[model samples]
Every structure is written in structure tokens, then in C-alpha cells.
Target: MFIRLPRKLFLFYVSVFYLIGIPVHAENNTAPTGSFKSKACMECHKKNNPLLIKDWRSSAHANTQPITDCVACHGKLHQAAASSSRRDSTCIRCHGGKKDPVVHSYTTSKHGVLMQLEKRSYDWNQPLADANYRAPGCSYCHMHKAGHNVSAGIRDDLMDKAAEKKVREQTRIACLDCHAPRYITRLFENGERMLEIGRKKVREARSLIEQSSVTFSDDELAPARAQLVKMQQHLTNVYLGVAHQSPDYQWWHGHPALDGDLLRIKGFIGELYRIKK
Candidate 1:
């Protein structure tokens, strides 16, 4: 009942269990999906081009779950001589739309507008020291120093709230390179205030919707649902479009659209209430 097996015998038994596909450990640790352990990229790039490897290794991309290797961004058919001008599209593939709402907002921002007008292109491998480059691109703010940490120093309301202060401080330091500290601070504070007001309005609309759902038929409730969706889209536009530096969107598109949607929601609620009475 208390026999102590020899260490060699114990090791041999563990080997047998493992070889037979029986798990000895209780923990179900598995690698993330879309991840690979192959060092094929590093094996070649490390010696031929050391700096590239170093840059990637230092980036958040290397550390994040579902870890990305060169193949993730560059595609499986990547060649050393392949043109890097297409990286922006590749970035948008994962970061655009609902995947990252800020990126969606950026597409409609002034910078995006100018880029489209001028037919400008951004290549991450290229240096930005040229004076001809008038506006900041995605790489300018997020990928400075060719750093892979896309969210570095960004103050995203969608991200972790606990880190907001630290992120804001870091973002201020980044902004100080081009803007006055006072201006940057005011801009960020205003953005926060705008986001707060938008959130409150959305909450009020949602409350009205919930109350309407209790009495209104599906056909009657359809317009309310449509208005609520519009309200959320405008609120998101306000929050993210400001952060993306689109003044016109914040004032002309986002704010006005949100106000109209809120009114529509209120009108729908009043109509439903009158019907109920």
C-alpha cells in the first residue's frame, strides 16, 4: 500500500502514459488559435536582417494572444522582394470596421481624406523623417520607432479603464512632440466629456426602448430599433472620430446625427405611450 517506486521506473511509467496519449497533468493548456511555433521567419531574417527581427520582437504583436508572425500580416506567399506598399490594406483587414471601431472612424477622418486626395501611401519599413510628409499616418502615432505595439500610449475608452490615467499620460508625452501640452490636454478632456454625454444619451434611449418593448408591437417597435441603432452609430462616430482628429465629423456629422436620433427615439417613445394610454 505504501510502496515507493524507483525514480527510473516512475519516469518510465510517465513516458509510457505520454506515448499512449494519456494526459498526466490536469491543466488543459493549449496554444492559441492562428498561432505557430515555427521559427522559420526568425531563422532567416535574424541573420540577413537583424533589425527587422528586433523590431518585431519588441512589438505588442509578438506578445499578444493568437500571436502574429510575419505570415499573419505579410501573407503566406511573402517574398523578400515583395512590395511593402500594400501593408496599409493588410492592417485594415484585421483592424477595420467592428474589429476596431477607432480604425473605422479613422477611415472617415481628415487625414484619411487627405491621403485619398493626394493618393499617398504608407510603408512601415520607410522612415518618416522626410519634410514632405504633411500629415500623420497610422504608423506615425501608433507605430513610432517601428514599434509593433499598436495601442502604445493610446487613451482608448474601449480599452481597460484602470489603465486610462497611465495611457493618457503616455499619450500626452507623445502628443507633446507636435502640439502644445495645454492644447493636447484640452482636446483630450473635451473628447472625454463628449464621450460621457453621448453615453448618457444612448443610455436614456435604451431605457426608453426597454419600456416601449413592454407595450409596443414588433411592427411599431421597428422604427424605435432603427433610431436606436442610428443613435449608437452617431455616438460611436463622435467618440472615435474625435480621437481620429476629424473635427468636421465630431461637430457636423457625429453631434448633429446623435441629436436627431435622440429626438427620433423620444418621439417614438411618446407615440407608444399615447397608444398605451
Candidate 2:
């Protein structure tokens, strides 16, 4: 008999070194709409990296990255009339173009999918998350904040040009930000969900063995099929965009269970399928 593992237990076997899961359940998905303070972030960042401004000059966020910085999305809304949810429709407005280079690739990403269908697909009502720091999106990752320590230093070691201390630190911080508590929590959660998918896939493949020893009937198999399909839905919803259509993720992370062999993935992506690709 093949080995069987439960979702929670199986996930432990496949998580990245730093990932860990946290359970969260919410029914309401109201958006946040508060104008948080941004003058502070702007004050120092403007002086630190002049070029940073250029990146946003013609970009969507620049036009409306929320002058309130992180708070704009995480906090609350209080203006001319009253409070309101931060509608994601605003984000989709300029980023909806499929052929537009800057946002085209991102829109097709899982994050894009989540953002687009957040209200309808899952519980999007802003929840406390029992999280100390509110989750930040495109803005927090790119913008600077008050008391924002800047260790940006010269990377002459790599880039011939001297690195702007502020810019470098912000970049480093961005990576570290992913490795933080929230990052680990998210990965572990994804892993746990994947483990269930992995189990369902195994069951599906076994059913195809067509051996005397094989046991499940069509009616009995219906549930597994449904589960696996749900997992694939998640595959498209969650993991498809991280590395783009890279061979490794499509294979190791996405394909194996979808098709019995990883080669199917490699063939689909072909060469030049690495992340850097």
C-alpha cells in the first residue's frame, strides 16, 4: 500500500526553510480606506534617492500611490464625507491592460487574480489578521517610511557604480520583509494547502493504475477528483506567477501531480524557462 499523509503533516515535509503557517478565518471582506501619514516617508526618501521618484513619475502608483503610504490601505478612511472601503477597482483601472509591458505580466499573476477577484473569490473583508503590522502591498514594498533606518551602502563590489545607501537598504529591506513573520506565515499556509493538493493528486494517479489491487470505484473517486480540481484552481490562483512560467515551479511546484511526469512541464515551458528567463 502507498503511504498516506494528512495535509498538516505533509506540508512540513515540503516547506521552504523559513515558512510557517498561521490559521485565519474571516467572513467579512470590507476594504480599508484611511488616509495614513505619508509626509514622513516622503520627507527623507526624497533626499535619499532622487531617482526613486522617477520610477513612479510615469507609473500608475505615482499617479495614485496614496499620499498616505502604507496607512492608506491598512488603516481607515475619514475625509470629506465619511469612511469607506478601499475599492480594488482603483488598482485595476490603470493596470487592466493586457498588452501593456509594465503591468501586463503582473496582472496575469496570482496576486493579480487575488486582487481582482478578492471580493468574490474569498473572504476579502479586511481582517485584523491578529497581525501586529498590517499587510502592505505594492506601496509599502517600494516606498520609504519615517524613522526608516537607511543602511544603503556602496555595492561597488557588484555594480561598478556606488550604491545609494538609502536605495540599497530599502532593497535589502524589501527582501527581508518577505522573510519576516508575515512572509513565513503565508508560505506555510500555502504549503499546508499544497499538501492537501498533493494527497489528492496521489489518489487520482493511483486510481488510474487499473490493477486488481487498485480499489476505488468511479463514485468513490468523485470526491478525490473534485479535491484535485480545487487544488489546480488554487494552482492557478496562488502559485502560477511567482516565477512566471518557469520550468522548475511548473514542474516541481505545479506539474507532477497534474500529469504523472514532470517532463510534461519541461516540455510545456521548453528551454529558456528558468526564473531569470
Best by TM-score: 1
In candidate 2, position 258 carries an lDDT of 57
TM-score of each: 0.61, 0.26
Q: Which parts of model 2 are misplaced by more than 4 Å?
A: 1-98, 119-137, 143-168, 171-277
Worst 10 residues of 1 by lDDT: 24-33
Per-residue CA lDDT of candidate 1, range 4-48, in tens?
A: 567778899888888765352323422123433337656756875
Show where candidate 1 strays beyond 4 Å: 1-39, 42-68, 72-90, 93-110, 113-133, 152-163, 213-222
Cα displacement (Å) at residue 266, model 1? 1.1
User: How many collisions per candidate?
Assistant: 0, 9
Q: Local error of candidate 1 at 41, Å?
A: 2.3
